[model samples]
Target: MSQKSQNQRPDEQPEEPKADDVADSSGTRAAEPAPAQDEAADEVAPADAATVPTGTDGPVEGPGTADGAPGDRDPAGRDALDRALTDDMNFRTPDEIRSGDATQYPAHEASAAPEDDRPSAEAPPEPDAARDREPETAASLTADRLLDARDRAPVAGWRRWLYRATLGRVNVGDSDAVRLRRLRENSIKTPLTGGTRYVTVLSRKGGVGKTTATTLLGMALAEVREDRVAALDANPDRGTLSDRSPGQTRYTARQLVQNRYLVDSFAKISQYASRQGSRLHVLASDTDPHVAEAFDDADYRAVTDLMGKFYSIVLTDSGTGMVHSVMQGSLEKSDVVVLVSGASVDEARLASETLSWLEAHGRQDLARNAIVVINQSAGLARGVNVDEIEAHFSSRVDSVVRLPYDAHLAEGSEVSLDRLRPATREAVMELASLVVDELRGTR
Candidate 1:
C-alpha cells in the first residue's frame, strides 16, 4: 500500500480479536477510522492542558513556555477579561469599571440613597438663614420685659402725670397747693373715734415712700374712719416717721420690739405709744440705729401680738432693708402687705424682681395678699402712668392712691385734720375706706 493509504489504515489485529478492538472497530465508520480515534484521545486529556490566555487573542503561556504552552496573551487582554468578569459578576457600570484597576467588585442591588448623609435619624435640624435674618415682630417682645424696661426709663410731661396716678408723690411737688385746696374742700366734719386700726408700711426698695406713705395713711385712716389709729415706725434704721409726726414722744417702736415683758403692761405700752390727740397715735423709731437692730424676731412677734390685741388697727412702719428678719417675719404674718414703689423705672424694675423673688420662694400666697402702692415722691408734674406702673409689677396694683405733693405735710408742723391737701387727703381716705371694707369682711 502507498504512504497516504497507510496513514488512514486501521491497526493490525490478532487472529482472536480483543474485546476493546472489537468495540472500537464497531463504533468507527470505515471512512475515518484512525483520525477519529486520535480526536477522541485528545478530548480525554486533564483540564490543566489548557492554560489562561496571555498577549492578545492567544492562550496564556505556562511557566517554562516561551510563546506560552497553550493559551497565551498580552497584559491588556488579561486585564480586559478581568474587567468583563467583574462587570458581569458585580453589575458595575462600564464607566466605573474603566476608571481604574478592576480588582474590587460592586455590591449587588443596594437601596436608594438616604435624604441625609448622617447615620442618626435624630440629628438636630439646621437653622435656615432666611428665617434667622428676618426682623423681630412685636409679639417677640414679652409684656413683662417691656414693662420692666419701661420702669427704668425716664419720664416727661404727661408721663409725669401718669407716674403720679400710680405712685403718689414722695416729696412736695408742683401740685401741692392744688392738693391742699382739694383736701380743704373734701374734709368731713365727722368726730374722731377711740377704736384704733393698725397698719404696717413696707418695701424691699429704699426711697420708695415706705415711711412717708405709712405716716400719711395712718393720718388718713384716722381722719376718714373717725377711728383711733397709730403709725408705729418699726424700722430699725430710725427713719423719717418721727420727723413726720408733730407731737413729742420719747419712747419708740424699738423699745416695744426689744422689751416683750413691757408689752404685757398696757400702761407701759401706752407710755411708748405717742399720742396725736383723740384718734391717732405715733410710735416713732429710736434715734439710735444700732438700738433698733438689737431687736429680733421673737421680740417683734411679742410686741405685735400684744399690740394686735389692744389696737383695732396697728400700722407698722417697717424699714427698707433685706437683712431685717424680724420685719420680714412681720410682713409674712400681717393681714395684708402694702408693697410701696416709686414711679421711677429703677423702682418699678426692682419691685418686679423683688416680687418675683418672693413668689419663687413659695411665697405666692403672700404675694397674692400684697397691695402695690406707687409712690410719686419726686413730684414730677407728669410722672409714670398708672398703667405703666402696673405693667412693671409681678402682682396687681389693687388701688392707685395718688398723694399729691404737699409741703405742709412734709414740714413736720402741728397736726391738724385741715392741714392735708385735698387730692392727697381724698386718695388716702379712699384707701382707708377700702382697708375698712377688707377688714370688715375678714372679721
Candidate 2:
C-alpha cells in the first residue's frame, strides 16, 4: 500500500464485507470492503489524524488519550488547563465568576462536575485580631519601670549645680563629679584573686627617680585598691623608699629576711614594714649603705616570698644597676616593669640603653612591654627635645608617661596623692589604670 493509504487512522478504516459478498469457487469465504467505501471513509478523516498511531505499538490507552475508554478516564483529572487555553473560560468577566453561572460557557462542558463542590469564592478572612494588633515596643515595655542598671554610677558634680540654678533643685550630681567618682571606684576595685602581681621600677642610673616612681605608683595603686599593696626597696644600696612612707618600724628588709620564719600574717609582716595609711605597706631597704650592698638575690627571694603571702601587689624599687643581683630577683618575679628616666638627654639615653641591655639579655619581652616614665624633676633643659624623647621611648615601649614637676614631689618627702598637684594626680591615675588593665589581661 502507498504511504498515504497506510497512514489512515483506525477510526477511519473501511468496514469489513459480509460473508455473502465474499463467496468464492470452493465455497470458501473472503471478506473485503468495496473500493468506493474505502475512498469515502478516507475523505472524512481530518489531517490532524496523522498524529494517531495505527499499529500494535500505538500510544497506550490512558487519561486524555483519543482511544481511551470514556469510563477509564481519570475522573479526578482537571480540564481547567484545556479550558483556559482553548475555550472562552479565561475571557469570563469577574462578575460572571462571582455569579457562579457555569451554563453561560457551554464550551467548558468538559469541566462540568455532576455535583458542584468547589468552595464558594469569597473575600479573604479578616486577619486575626491578635495578629493585627501592634507589637509592644522597648519604650512601652520599660515605661512602668523606675530603675536602670549602669556599669558605673551616674555623674553628680556640675549637673547638680545646673539643676539648682535652672529648676531650683539640688542633689543632682553633674557629669564631672560622676565621672571622677566612677574613676575613683574603678581605680580601687582590683579583684583579690590569683597569685601576687609584681611591678618593678628600675633605672640604670641613680637620681632618675626609680625609688620615687616606685613609691608614688604604690601610693596611687594602694589608695585606690582595697587589697594590700606594698613597695619594696630592692636596692642593693641603701635606698630611700621607706622615707616616702611614715617610718613606723626600725626593722628593715634585712630584719624581715632574718625573721622570715616568724612573718606569717599581715600583723607579723607589719612589724618589719611600715604601713602608709591602711592600704599601702612599705618594706624599707638597709639603712647602712655598707650593709645594703650585701642584700643579694637570696635576701630578695626571702623577703618577696614572705611578703607575697600578705600582699596582692608588690612594687619593687630596684637598685640603679640592671646587673645587680637584687634586680635579677626583681625581674624574675616581676609581671610588669616600669622603666624610670629623667627628662634630661643623659637620663633618657641611659634609660633607652637599659632597655637595650634587657633586650640583649633574655628579658626582651619584658623590655618591650615595660612602661617608660619620664620624670620632669627639674625645669626643662634648653635646646633639649622632651617630646622627641617621649616619642622615641614610646616606640620602644608599650607606653610612655611624663611626670610633671610638683613641689610636693620635688621635696621628696612622704609621697601622698593629696599633696601632689591635680595634674600630677591625674598622670598617676592614668599610669595606675594602664597597670590595672595589664593585670586584667595577664589574668
Candidate 3:
C-alpha cells in the first residue's frame, strides 16, 4: 500500500509470490531466491540441494565455482567457501589426476606456499664427463658378457659335473717318460705266483677257428720266444691238430698215457715229441678216436704236471662234447682258458650255453680266463662285432682273430708263417700278442 504499490498497475500487479518466498510479520525480508532459470525452465530438475544452491548471494556456488579466488564470499559463507577453496586447490586437471582419486586434499593456502615443497618441472641429465673419467675393468662387465668370447662356457654345479662325467675329462698334457718307466718297474717288481701251466681253447660250436687258435698260439710261443711250447689234442676225434699241421711228428698222446713212468722225464719224453718248429712240440692225439675214453683222471694229471716242468706254455684243444673225466682233469690244471666263437648268432648262443655249463660244473675260475676269438674264415662271413657277442656272454671279450680261409692251410699240408697274407699274418700276430701278454705278462 505504499508508493511502490500505487505505481503498479493492475496488469502489472506482481505475479503471485514464487514458492521460494513467504510474508513474515517482522517486516525483515525473508525469501528464497527462485531456483536457477535453467533449472526452473526444465521440469525434471535434480532434487539434491547440494547440486542447486538457494538464497540471493547472486548465484550460490556450484562445485565448479570453487576455482575462484578467496575473499569472494560473505563472512557467514567463509567456512563452506574455505572448504570449497581447499578442495579446488587439491583438485587436479584430468591429465594430472590418477584414475583412482587417491590424492590428499591440499591446504587452502597451497597455491601461495613456498617453492621448496613442490618438485621442479625439469631435471638435469647424467653427466658424460663423470662416466668417461671412471676406471674400466673386467669386473665392471656382467658375468655373461665376460664369457662371451669362449667357445663353450662352463655351467655351474650339477650341470658342469654331468657334462664332464659323460665325456671323460680332456687330458691336455703329453705322456712323460718318467711315468712310463715307473709303470714298467711296478709290473716287473710283481712276482708270478707259479700259476697253473695248462691252456685251454674251447668252442661250444665247431668251425669257429678254436683248433687253429690253440695250434697257432703254441706255434707262436715256440717260434717267437724259444720257450718250450707243447700242443695237446684232447679232441675225442683225435688228429685235428696233426691233420691241420701235416708232416707233424707221428708220436701220439696214446703212447705217453700208455707208459705212465715216461711222463716224469722231459729228456726221455722229448723223443716222443714231434717238433713242429723250433721249440713247438706236438703231443698228437691217439690215431684211435676211442683212446680219449681209455684215459682217466690220473693220466691227465700226470701228463699235465710232467709237461709243466719242461714247457712254459701248454695249449689244450678241447672238443665240443660234454665233460669227460679226462677233459675235466685237463681243465682243472689249466692256467688260462681260451673260448672261441664265431660272429653268428647260433655260435654266440651256443658259447653262452657252454659258458653256463662250465660255471655250473665249478669251472667258473677257468671260464674267467676264457677269451672269445672271432674267426673270419673264407672272408665271406660278416666281420663279427665283439660288442654284440659280449652282450650275450655278459663279459668283456679278450680278442678277435680273423683267419683267411686259405686253400693251402685247409689242406693237410705244412703251412709256414711266411705263406700267409700280410693281413692274415697280422691278425694271427695280434692273437699271439694277447696270449703272450696274458700268460707271460709281457707286452
Candidate 4:
C-alpha cells in the first residue's frame, strides 16, 4: 500500500465521498479540502459562490457563506451548513469578502441614524408674524397712496385770479390749467378692479348720442370719480335716460326689477336711481313703451346685478334695437364700448356696421375695444367728413371721441353739469379722460 501510494490512478481516486461529504457522527466537522487559490487570486468564481463552493476552505467564513466572509468554517459538512446558513446570512467583512460588497445588516446599521442623533433636518422656525416681514417690492406691489380727497376743485374764482395775476405765470401757463390737470389725472387713476365696468353706450342708430352718450358719460364719470357712477337706461324704447337725469325717482328700471329683494344698499339702490349730480346715478327706462317692451334679459340681469352692488361705473344706455331683447343684457355686460356715431354718411355707416356686428358676434374682443363717439349731431354736418369720420373710426377703434354740438347737450332737458359750456365742459373733460384712460389701461 506504499509504492508511492501504490502507483495510484483509478482516475486518481480521491474525490468520491460527496453527498455534501458526510461527516456528522452526531458531532460534525470533517470535510475540509479545497483552499489553495491565490495564484494572484481570480480564477473568477465568487458571484455568491457560483454554484456554491464557499468554505470547503476557499471562500465562506462568517457572513454565513456564499462568499461574504468573517473568517473560519469549512470542513465540508459545511459547519452544519454554516449553522444552517447562520439563520439566513448577511454577516459581512473580510473587506466585504473579496470585494463583492452589499452586506450592512445589524438591522441595517440601526436604521442608519447617527448624524448627531438627527431629529430636525432644518426648515421650521418662521412665523413670529413672519419674522418682522418686509419683502414684497415692485413698489410695494403698487403702493396706493390713499386718494379721493372727495371732489377737490374749489379754487376757481377764475383759478384764484390767475394765480394772483401771474405771479405763477398765468397759473403755470394754463391751457385750462393743463386740461384740468389731465382731467384730474385721468379721473383719479385706479378704478377697475375685479368687477363692474360695463360702459356700453351703444347705437346701431337712434339720433346717435345713445342717450346723449349715456348722459354725458354718466355726468363725466360722476364728475370725476370718487367711484360709484351709473347710468343704465338700457333703453328698451322710451329711454332718453329718464329724460336725462330728471330725478326725484319715480322708481323705474321697472321699479327696481319689481322690488328686487328690496334692493340692498347704495342707499337701497339710491331709491331706484336718478340722483344725477352728487355722483350721477340714473337707471331709468320704463317710460311705458309698453312697459319698455317688457324689459327682458332677465330684467337686464336684475338691474345690472343690483347696480353691480352699487356701481363702480356702469353707464349702459344701450338701445336703438341692435337685435333687441334688451340686447341680451347689453351685449353681455359690455365692459367698455361707447360706439355712438352721428357725424353722418349714415352715421359713419352705422358705426362701421356696429363694428362689423361686433366682429360677427363672438365679440372679437368687443370689436377691438371700441370707443368711437363722434356725436357732433347737427353742427359738424356740412356733408361731414370729420377727418373721414376720424379715419374711419381710427381703423375700427380703441378710441375716437368728438361730441361737440351742445345747446347744453342739445336740449335733452335735465342734464346740468352747471349747464355745460366752457367748450362743452372741456369736451366732457376730454371724454372723461378717455374713459378714465381706458379704465386705467385695463386695470
TM-score of each: 0.50, 0.66, 0.51, 0.28
After superposing candidate 1 on the true structure, give the runs of residues whose Cα lies further than 4 Å from its correct spot: 1-198, 257-267, 289-293, 381-387, 390-395, 409-417
Against the correct fold, how does model 2 do in TM-score? 0.66
Name the candidate that leads on lDDT.
Answer: 2
Q: Which ten residues in a row have the lowest lDDT in candidate 4?
A: 142-151
Question: How much is the lDDT of residue 265 in candidate 1?
Answer: 58
Q: Comparing 1 and 3 by lDDT, which wins?
A: 3
Listed per model in order, the count of residue pairs whose N, CA or C atoms clash below 3 Å is 52, 8, 0, 2
Candidate 4 residues lying further than 4 Å off, grouped into runs, are 1-58, 62-99, 102-202, 208-213, 216-335, 339-363, 368-411, 416-443
What C-alpha root-mean-square deviation, in Å, does candidate 4 show against the real structure? 21.7
Ranking by TM-score: 2, 3, 1, 4
Model 1: how far residue 108 lies from native, Å: 94
lDDT by residue for model 1 (168-258), tens: 4332233444444334323322322334334456677887777777766677665554334666666655567767666678876656766
Error of 2 at 168 (Å): 5.4
lDDT of 1 at 399: 47
Q: Write the per-residue lDDT of candidate 2 for residues 1-443, one digit (tens) a residue.
A: 23455676657755465676678887987645437655555556445333322233442243353434321123332243233323434544334545644444553443455435544567567689999886643333321133332322333456545655765434343355345644644644656457899888899889888887887788888887767888888877778888878656588998888888877778888777788464578888878745524789999999899888888999998888788788888888888889989989889999999999988889987887898999985556788888999999978987888899888888877777777887888778778877876775665
Residue 69 shift from truth in candidate 2, angstroms: 8.8
Model 3 regions more than 4 Å off: 1-196, 276-278, 289-293, 382-387, 390-395, 398-408, 440-443
Residue 359 in candidate 4, Cα distance off native in Å: 1.8
